[model samples]
Target: MKTKDKIMIFFLTIITFGTIWIYWNSKKKNNKKNELSRSEKISFDINDLILFLGDINNIQNVENTHKKVKIYIKDSNLVKTEEIQKLKGISSTLVSSEYVNIIVGNVAEFLKEELSRKMEK
Candidate 1:
């Protein structure tokens, strides 16, 4: 090939490789950052209901009634109460074999969306 054509091809090849290297390294760095950062805990109270969630704590609630405070472990899949009760904040769980109902009032709508976003990451 002519010297000018050869030089142009070399520059193009270098540019392509450099771009690929930069893209791959950027993606790896972003993934590493996500792995290193922990999920943030969120808390909010409306009326007599309380909500709390963390890495160790999936999703839970403490409902205050006239005379009793009840705990509920909420999840999309059925989980043993014994395993859930073992976690802090879940004093006594009814132990459900059914997946949590999204329509249920235990989890507020906005918080559920936020949790879903976090889990996606």
Candidate 2:
């Protein structure tokens, strides 16, 4: 082939590969964004309870109480009785003191609820 023709072919090949790479990268970024959104939803769902745990940092313990699971936070003193009562209405029960223990019977319940909402669309 002529030098000019070979050079043109090479440039075209490079452009094609570059376009494919860009498209793939964009798709990956979108997937990551979707995953991040889902993660944020889960985090937001538990944010209030986490904050109510008080100044103490970190989750101390988690226990299964029958079908319910209890999460004990390091500092429970920050939790208010009214807030605990509201939480109990949402799930099985919520107990808070110097350390907070929240009982959620089914962790998957939130995910299931979210999934069903999505499926409705």
Candidate 3:
């Protein structure tokens, strides 16, 4: 093949691969960002709830009025039962698993209260 033709072909190949790489990387980044922004629904096992209440003490009026509890945590899925227990254990009133309903505006609070109530039993 002529030198000019070969050079043209090489450049075209490079451009095509570069475009594909950039597109792929951008798409991957967008997906990661979306995942970070999305909210997560977390379900806690009964045992984990008990451990959480042992840690937190400030939580008051913890009552279990629902058979099942579900909460939405925005932008995070990591929940430590130990940390929740620490916060609820500090509450002035003893948590009860029978009739207490701790309501919060955010997912973290909801989980904290629910776990605290479960532990109270």
RMSD of 1: 14.2
Instruction: Quote the positional error of residue 67 for candidate 3 in Å.
Output: 25
Query: Per-residue lDDT tens digits of candidate 2, residues 1-121?
Result: 8999999999999999999999999988877644212211333245455454442244554444333445555555555546644653245355645333444444434533443343344
> Estimated TM-score per prediction?
0.29, 0.37, 0.32
- Residues 1-113, candidate 1, lDDT per residue (tens digit)? 89999999999999999999999999888776442222223233321122222241444544333222333455534344344344432334443433222222223344344
- Model 3 TM: 0.32
Which scores higher on TM-score, 1 or 3? Answer: 3
Ranking by TM-score: 2, 3, 1
The lDDT ranking, best first, is 2, 3, 1
Residue 64 lDDT in candidate 2 = 44
Stretch of 10 with least lDDT, candidate 3: 68-77
Better of 1 and 2 by TM-score: 2
Off by over 4 Å in 1: 33-121
Provide the lDDT at 63 for model 3: 30
Between prediction 1 and prediction 3, the one with superior lDDT is: 3
